[model samples]
Target: MRKGIIGDILHGEAAYIHDLRYQMKMKTGEGVWRPYHLAKRNGNLYPTHGLGPVAQYMNLARTDDQFNTIISYSTPAIGRNKYAKKISQRKTYGINRF
Candidate 1:
């Protein structure tokens, strides 16, 4: 018969270490969102920070492969509607909301 003890001794330690590391990162303040914005006309990706680990994740200056392209457009009429609401609110408050 094959010994089950042999397999447990070999693989158990590695499984325990992996779980410990994952838990530690979770306990510490390690993850947060970094904002990225794109202009209405230009299709470009803008990250708030550069260099180090974030750069590796975002893939800046090495390759453009990391970026997900987005396209957007707004007409003059859309601008007018936005402006109208702002003006109305501003007139009521006697100050600009933005």
Candidate 2:
């Protein structure tokens, strides 16, 4: 789980799938829909997780009165590319990555 691997993270993601399966009366080990982790190129992975709370607090005051702009930056994506390469290698070895 400590490694920056997609499969490792998805093993933990089973909790969310389990919850959904329970509501639908499906088995806990039911198969998942493919492409569940298909994130778009340069897109938000969980936009609502960040935006939902902010939208609910529209009246919140900012520390700087002249707050008219916001910006963000992301570091290089070595970790992500490495995970993709690992997944690719698994496919080449006929491994069940999920």
Model 2 clashing-pair count: 0
Give the number of the best model, judged by lDDT. 2
Residue range 1-98, candidate 1, lDDT tens digits? 02444342221111111112222112224311111111122222222222234444444456654435433332333443354355444222211222
In model 2, pairs of residues that clash are none
lDDT of 2 at 61: 38
The candidate 2 region of ten consecutive residues with least summed lDDT is 10-19
TM-score, cand. 1 vs. native: 0.17
**On residues 33-67, what C-alpha lDDT tens digit does candidate 2 reach at each position?**
32233322343344445544443333223332232
The reply for model 1, stretches above 4 Å from the true place, is 1-56, 64-71, 74-98
Best by TM-score, which number?
Answer: 2
lDDT comparing candidate 2 with the true structure: 0.32
